[model samples]
Target: MKNNRFLSILFICLLLAVGVSAQNTVKTSVPDTIIIPVVPDSDTIGIARVRNELAAAKLNEANMRMEIELLKYQADAADSLKQAKQMQRIDSLRALTPGVPVVVTGDTLFYLYAKRGGYTPQQRAQMDADAIEELGKRFNLNPDSVYIESTDIVTDIMYGNKVIVSFTDQDGLWANCSRDQLAAKERQVIVQKLKELKEEHSAWQLGKRILYFILVLAGQYLLFWLTSWLYRKLKVRIQKLKDTKLKPISIQNYQLLDTQKQVNLLIFLANIGRYVVMLLQLLITVPLLFSIFPQTKDLAYTIFSYIWNPVKSIFWGIVEYIPNLFTIIIIYYAVKYLVKGLRYLATEIDSGHLKITGFYPDWALPTFHIFRFLLYAFMIAMIYPYLPGADSDIFKGISVFVGLIVSLGSSTVIGNIMAGLVITYMRPFKLGDRIKLNDTTGNVIEKTALVTRIKTPKNELVTIPNSFIMSSHTVNYSSSARTYGLIIHTEVSIGYDVPWRKVHQLLIDSALATEGVSADPEPFVLETSLQDWYPVYQINAYIKEADKLTQIHSDLLQNIQDKFAEADVEIMSPHYMAMRDGNESTIPKEDIKPQTTGTGSTKPA
Candidate 1:
């Protein structure tokens, strides 16, 4: 009986050991085949075979967890239903082969697959954005509360313990980045965007912005009123200055600016002050108003840039051009001093204080002017490159345009200028000279670079262009009148019956009697022509004063008429056709006294 009981206990102990070993085998063993109901039969067979082989190989616990995490990341990251379906297919394939290695790659966020679960990168990004928006809405969570948790196998973006998004090694491999690194970066972007939205919608921030806007509006109104008041004050001050202290400026006896001009200038300045005040007010108000709101802060900066940028550039440009400005100043002063010296020399020459061998006194002023113009032009050329913006395309273009206009319009002006220069050098006439040009006889009043002005004896003022003067014939009467007196001549007709000796004596006696006729030179008479019935007698006399020629000629004729009449000569200036009786003669009957007969008889009675 004891032996039988011992045998039974041993058998039961063996059976229990076998059962425990079988349970252990079942727990550790891997299936050689896997069947998938969702996949196609052919694909399923191949996938199952591969999966069975991997299971038989028995991958480590960590690797299996990584694979599961990768599959879940792909499924969650899908953007569309098609993408989800594709991700499901991929996950099924991955589950079939658990130990397969996955790649994740990106600098910031890793992609699990090249196609991102059949969705493009852009689509996936948009989906991620949508998910973040939904998470924010659902949790009503502040972006500040959102955070990321990273581990060796997976990374999770959380909003207060709620997983908003996740990343895995597969995502890291797709993005060419570490999983934790990508998740952290994603967390930062989402948090920043959500924070912006929250701040934008926050009632406190909105109220603060509104308060700033109202203050800015009030400030703008105050600025406007202040500027207006200041502008009025400035106008009053400017008017006062114009009336009292800043009256028309005069130099010596000449008025440089008249009263009207001064008033106009003051008014213009006042207007400018008003406009500037208004502009300043606008410039200040606009930027401030825009800057009061967050939405328009960037716009405020943009508007400010419109005004500030040019001013900044100009300020810096001026700073940078300081050296060039100094160079220009030196050139200007040097040219100015040199021109001043030249002008002094020219003045001396013109005034006859300094004499040059080949240069005429009249040419001094014009030559100086020409030299000054050339020197100024040369200085301008030298200083042009040093001018701010001189090298710029706009400046060059303006220069070209101006040059073209000058060249086209200055042809006649240049011609006149050249003629004036020629006339100066030729010395045809000087100022105050009595000259006859064309048909106009006048005294030269003024000579300029472009024109000559003359005052005629009738007090008529005439301005003739220098070019016209150069082209016309010029007769200068006063040029030699000082050295040799100008001649005055008159002619009279006498009857041929008169004795030539008597006529000559009468003419000489009449010329001698005329006033203003130089007695030293003496007056003379000539029988110029013998007509059919009369002889033309010419009386010539010299007068020292050319201006007195008219008066002298009139006096000479009066003296001749009186002398001929006193001599009782028959002055037959016109031809006489008469039927003469024996007692009648060419002499006036009244002037002819009847001869006193010896018998004292009245012959006519």
Candidate 2:
């Protein structure tokens, strides 16, 4: 009766709640206003009135807009009229100036000079003939006498003002006198000794060429001898000095000799000397040889122009490209050095010999990797413009193709690199850590861009991609192994007949007997399950040595078997039907006694 009353009260309360919720929802809603206020015949009266007012407003707005547009057009027309008037005034002013030219229309000085000094070919010829006639008239010295003589006229101006005109008769006055004097001298000398140089022109050429060749050969030999002598003497002195310095150290303390270092220093000095000599020779000999040997000057100029011009062009091109290239390279090196330094510092800190207190431990490694990726990407961008033919379509195509290829093929590489960086910053494990990722269990030997190398317990190297390591489940046995120690657990099955307490005792004893097992942690035995055939037991103990894990596990299992044998505990396994039966029975026979005389008795019957 009390339960029924309670149920009835709950049902009544639920009903009252639902009813009150519905009533409140209805009261909060807006009320309808169908009969509040009415403007009768809205379509005929109200809409018509609104339409009439809208039309009037639109007409007024249209008139105002048209007036505004007309005013704007009038303003623009006035501006154009003013511009035209101003242009006319400017033209009138320019027309008034003849010599005082307008600045915008004035000719340059070079043009004026060309106009004043230049003449057409016909005008020049006429001037020459007139000047020649005037020169003949002046030379004849009779003002009324008409004279004509062929002559050449030269014109020049001095000091920007004075003009000098000269005319010389084209007759052999000076040329005749000079030739006559040369002929007289030659005739006087021809009687004693005369050779026909024209007849022996080829032989003379050959002789001259041979003399030049001999001189060149002598000069080359002398230069070679001098250079060779200098080289020999300097090399001998350098060798003596080197021997003097190195011999004592080598004989007394060979370990401290550092001969390779000395050799490197010597090589550097030698290279400096060699470059200096080559530069000096090139500076002096090239110009001197071209200047002295005019015969070969054109060839030398052609060769040098062909070689040095391109070299200089290429050098200037390199100079222009270097700033951007160097910037990218500097950024790359900076990132590389930063990452390397961070790793070094991290290693030092982790080894317990160094500590950077108050530092944000998480920021260093991630920042380094970000800087690395950004710098390398920036370098690629900056270097693109400097590459030869980079502006061409072929280069663009190749660049795009390479970008696509890198994007497609480098997914794993990029993922691994990022994973390595992530691992460094997140610190799931460190070097020398015994970890299990997926199925590979090993100690972390090295971490690189693409993969992490681990040394397994079997002394084999296992290289796992960083992507795999990063994405998979990682069991870091050594992350907290030093503190909690690593739990070495093994599963065993025992027959159900053995008591659970006795099985637990045997497991604990076996784990305790195993080598490298920790005692303070104590051995533990877990009764994992009761199966149809056997009970499953897990023996667990803390073990420290990762390298000897397999040996320790083997020893542990052997110890468990021995311990269970001593405890007389039967380890359970699958049943065998043959072993289960007590006696042997043949197929198609059912408990028949041995009867050898059956056939003989039937025959007698």
Candidate 3:
């Protein structure tokens, strides 16, 4: 852009200087009568002589006017010829080069400004021929003797309104070269030098570019291979250490962690090493690329500047021995095992073997989880600053971006996490407790930071978010020791044709006969509703062993069905058909109507 501006300015100055020089060199023709001085021999002009001279000058001016008119006609004829020749030359240039530029005199400012050099041979030859012809016709100069340097057409006001043609020599004999020709020659020389320089440097540049590209590719491959090798070697070494009992398993009976800790440690180390290698590889390759390709200097410098602050701090910190970052990794693994051990101890307590007298049972579990969380959080805090990406602006920006993404896309997830926290503090239920949440009833199997798992009575396991359990109504059957114990209640409807007292007696007998029913509580039955076609009865049985509620419920239902079958009483489910008038006798008025109670209706027959 700057080079273009300088060329534009230089061209304008050359044009202005040519215009001023042309104005100064303009020649005017004069006759002999007009050339004589106005004064006579007295050192002043005599009027009579001056008057005689003026009359002669007037006669001479008349003749000069005729000659000027003839010259104007000739100049006009030359200009017309020049224009026609210029058009022919332009057409030839276009035919030869198609889109190349050919500037002509008398063109508009826009065209003149846009024109450039490097005209074709055909165009230059045609222009030179037409110029010679025009000059010979107008100036009476020999076509062979007139070597036209350049031609310019300008408006001539002095000669009755017509265009005038001017020309100069190509050599120093009759004239010097024109400003435009000198500029064209200078441009050609510079272009040739630039081409030579580019060719001179080409081989060296191409080799350097290829070498740098290969080096970068090789560096990337080497880094990947090294990390992969390190990971595999670390895994094998860990297995060997485990076999030799050099790495002891601190966690006991935890099915998920059977020598898995060592593998986890190895994986974590490999990840750190991989990122370090990537950073180093980039550091080396980036500068090499810029050195080989200097045109991309700004691009490489910009990238380096953006990363320098973050990477510099980390590299220098490590070099300064600012408490070896690997120590944080060691501490993290140590704390992880310690927590696992503590959890193992807790499970031992749950087995009814490791009992602690006078210990607050509810406090132990949440406290253990909190301690484990804090310990891990501290370890992460110690290690975060040392990680490569953590100190980067892009990483910081990514963190905010990730936070926004989580907030927008994971509202339910965050809510569930908060719900888990609430559930932990609320203590609605714990592992091994039979509970119902979100219409699912099961024994609590495991509770984690994010979700709770339950094993249903059918032996199917379900995972529910802790947040959902906290938000919904949860019935924890094992929350409190069964004071009145658990009651398994069931409802049934019998046809109105059966006697209400007989139905009540049947349900009470069925409940008492069921296994796991409490003897002291005694079974009870109630008439709940009297519908148009059936009477509804509810049976309630309290069981001391709440854990056996499923078995007791099944037994109770079986006993009720057996008793009903023996009595020949029909059960009235939603699908039971009502007897038509022709199929069976109509229900009695007293059986259909509910019995009267104290200001309310009671169940009827």
Candidate 4:
């Protein structure tokens, strides 16, 4: 009870001191001089003025005494009931004053400041907030040592005499309440909040956090298991589908894809499903786990933003590109139909049904392909700008890189294409035509923009680049074989002793005996050279079938040998040097037998 009385006395003294300080703050600009009339009785006038001054001083003293006495009486009677009444008065004052919020430790406390106070509501609120924050920090460091104290001049919320916050007359006026009263209330709230914070750091709270972390981990594990189960089920379903329903898809009688390809596609789809499920699980799990902890909660939001922002951007980008996509589709189908029309024309021309005066039939397909390529390229060029991100630096850089690569590597390809074009227009040879280029003699089997393939007489397949073929000379045997038979020639050497007329007759007979040789154009023999050892006879035969030239040549040589042998003629074409007895002849002994004729003349067999 004595302690309560002392506290009350201290609080009242603090209030009285605040009032005195507020009174001292008042400024006076008026002069202290007073003029008095001195016409008659100057002493009486001076005395009357002195008495008036005394009376005024006494009245002012009496008013001050009355105020002090009222304060003492209120302080003495400041029990629970009187304090409640005072609080009511404070509440009424607050209703009239402007309220400003003072924020401390994330909590808001209202403060009211009166108009008569020098401080504005905002200034008072700011000051109170700063002081409270400082007090909170100090309370956090040493909560037990912090207390509120009232002195004769001021009330302070202090930590060992170091004032955390002070309340004076100006503060009371600004708050529109008793300074000590407001300070005490603020101190109690701040201390209570600090104690709550300390309690939150206790071992029990730590245990609770640990338990929550364990539960979260268990939940994440369960989610992982569920995700895995779902993926496995999906994969199994896909596998079963692949085994049963997903057979090889075919077009008409042709197999468009085989069973292996179907299985691979199913496996690919299953893998995609598995990975998608895993990714979704990871995304959900990571953010959830991060949100479970205060330290990583912000990071969780950041991570979500990192993925979501790009996904959102891509979704919007695709939505915005819908018109461009439609344009691209229109252009693509337009080019496709145009190419189809060109292909139909090419086919007709290639089949000789469509004739153009200047356009060769062989050029139709290749020209169509070339034109189609150019059209597609033009379509792509037209659509390039409308593509999403086409103007971005990365897209431009990739395009430039691709262009550079093509330009650097296409030199040989360009040459081949050009040579193929030239070869096509030149009409050197067509497919299945027997032709000879340099030393290679063959029938053309295939021709493309890059290379020409030939099947040689030896059944060897030879592929020659179009550029190489363009640079070499070519001889086409089948070109004129149909209209004018191609000539097949073979050379034979014979001893001068054998008559040239007889040799020519023998060569012509051999050529005529060859099956592929044309009978209409009679075979002829030319005495190409008169050498020292023998004469060179070239037998020229017309053959309607150029492809059978090799077989016919072989047959002709056999026929020549058989004819020469039958006539008992020795074929010593290359040079014959032999030591012969006087009776020995070049003919076979059996053929050298003598026979008697009708006139009794002897003849060699």
- What's the count of clashing pairs in each model shown? 14, 0, 1, 0
- Model 3 lDDT tens row, 1-605: 35645765576566557655643443222333335465546634465557667665765675566557656755776665665565565555544543222222212111111121454434543453343223323322222221223345211111112211222222111112343454344334323333443543466666877787788788778877887787678767766765565443554654544456766676677778778877777786776677556456567777777778688987897776445556767877888899999887766665555778865465466667777888888877777776666879998899799879988998877787778777776778878888888788889889877899999899989998877677689887765336567777899998877788898899998888888887667788877888887878999888776567788899999888777765556678654676566764333333343546787868554
Question: 1 or 3: which has the higher lDDT?
Answer: 1
Q: Write the per-residue lDDT of candidate 4 for residues 1-605, one digit (tens) a residue.
A: 47767876797787678666644442121113333546688787888689667655765686588588867777566655565565667677765765666676457765544332477667766776776555544324666666888887677878675665566754665555677887877777667765665555556766777788788778878877887787678767766776678777789999988766876676787778767877887787777777655446678889888889999999998999899999999988998999999999999999999999999898888889899989999999988998888999999999999999999999999999999989988999999999999999999999999999999999999999999998999999998788789988888988877898998899898889889998888999898998878878999999988898899889999888766765667677657754456755565565344767899998866
Q: How close is candidate 2 to the true structure, as a TM-score?
A: 0.46
- Give the whole-model CA lDDT for all candidates, comma-separated: 0.74, 0.59, 0.63, 0.78
Best-first order by lDDT: 4, 1, 3, 2
Candidate 1 lDDT over residue span 526-547, tens digit each: 8899887788999887777655
Query: Candidate 3, which ten residues in sequence have the lowest lDDT sum?
Result: 106-115
Candidate 1 Cα outliers beyond 4 Å, as residue runs: 1-141, 144-179, 185-201, 226-275, 505-516, 566-605
TM values, all candidates: 0.63, 0.46, 0.38, 0.62
Those runs of model 2 whose alpha carbons end farther than 4 Å from true positions after fitting are: 1-217, 232-290, 293-369, 372-409, 422-428, 479-486, 495-497, 515-523, 528-534, 542-551, 568-605
Candidate 1: what lDDT? Answer: 0.74
Cα deviation of 380, candidate 3, in Å: 2.1
Against the true structure, what is every candidate's RMSD?
A: 15.2, 41.4, 21.8, 14.0
Q: lDDT of model 4 at residue 402?
A: 98
Model 2 clash count equals 0
> Which candidate wins on lDDT?
4
